[model samples]
Target: MSPATSLTRNQKLAALAFVLGVALVYYASHPLLLCRQLIIRDDEALYARLHLGNDLPYAWLTESDYSFRLAEALLQGKLGLTEPPPEWVNETIPLRGRYYSVFPLGSVLTMLPFALAHRLIAFSPSGAAIALIGALATFLFLRFALRCGRNFRDAVWLTLFSTLGTWLWTNTAMGGAWQLALGFAMTGELAA
Candidate 1:
């Protein structure tokens, strides 16, 4: 392949790497220290809630906090792979009902593997991993957008702007991984 073709392949691989790394890091850095009930923050709470009660595997899955719930679901089986519930109801997985109807369903679908992996290891760990992954996706999406414009110089300028002046940086700093990913995805989509 020519240099241009090789460069394109690398960029594609970078995108894949970014997505996978986000999922893995989220899994590894997950707060293994905290208990499910003690997690009070809205986002964290949502994940904690999913695996609660008789719901067990699907405890945290809910409609109100769809994206985070979806993230949690994605991390279910990778680590230890939680034992299958005596009965599995697809609906119990949380975030499946209303979310699957309106949105593109891409994000929700992308989340399943990680959720399964984390569910296997432990619920909280999976949640933390998913959150980190979402944040990483947001950051990388922004970086990709900046780099794809004009040339390297223009890419640098855009990156600086996104880092300093945009919500991209703020969302990540605030630990709003979903927001980061949403903003990046929306901005890119709109731009396109």
Candidate 2:
């Protein structure tokens, strides 16, 4: 074949390799890592509230315990707590009968797309979309690696190791509030 054709074919092969490598890493990590329940937890619940436009009660931030508040919020037709839990009764923050969330909103912003889709689909699988995000992050990492002058083979290996052999897989699969937040942050940073 001509040189141009050979180069084009080689480029296609490289692209295929990159895609397959990312897929392999994502699959080997399992679709769900440490998540046991489909119900949202911790900061994830807060993010869900944010997505639903629910007001976060400031009292919930007084202590680490949030399960009861979340349950109450869900029961009250609110996405998050509407009242302060007992633990915050003594605090001096002068809540003035208002709800709030102490956590940064970055993670919630990152999860908005997924949250919106979940809202649209009544029965969408809970953790699968996050796994896909992890996979996308791996793909981006591979592309970034290649752009940094690593050979295609080296880039593939590096991407695999970074995604599967590190906390990236754990966080991506677990779907914890912080883990998902960190994953999105890393993915965004790499893309930038």
Q: Best by lDDT, which number? A: 2
Model 2, 1-192: lDDT tens digits are 332233357765776565665555554443232222223335455455446343654433222223223333444465545555455333212255655444354543454455455556742222544556666776787777777777666877887788778877766554445555676678888789
Off by over 4 Å in 2: 1-80, 83-99, 123-126
Q: Which stretches of candidate 1 lie over 4 Å from their true place?
A: 1-66, 70-107, 120-154, 172-181, 187-192
- TM-score of the candidate numbered 2? 0.55
lDDT (Cα) of model 2: 0.53
TM-score top scorer: 2
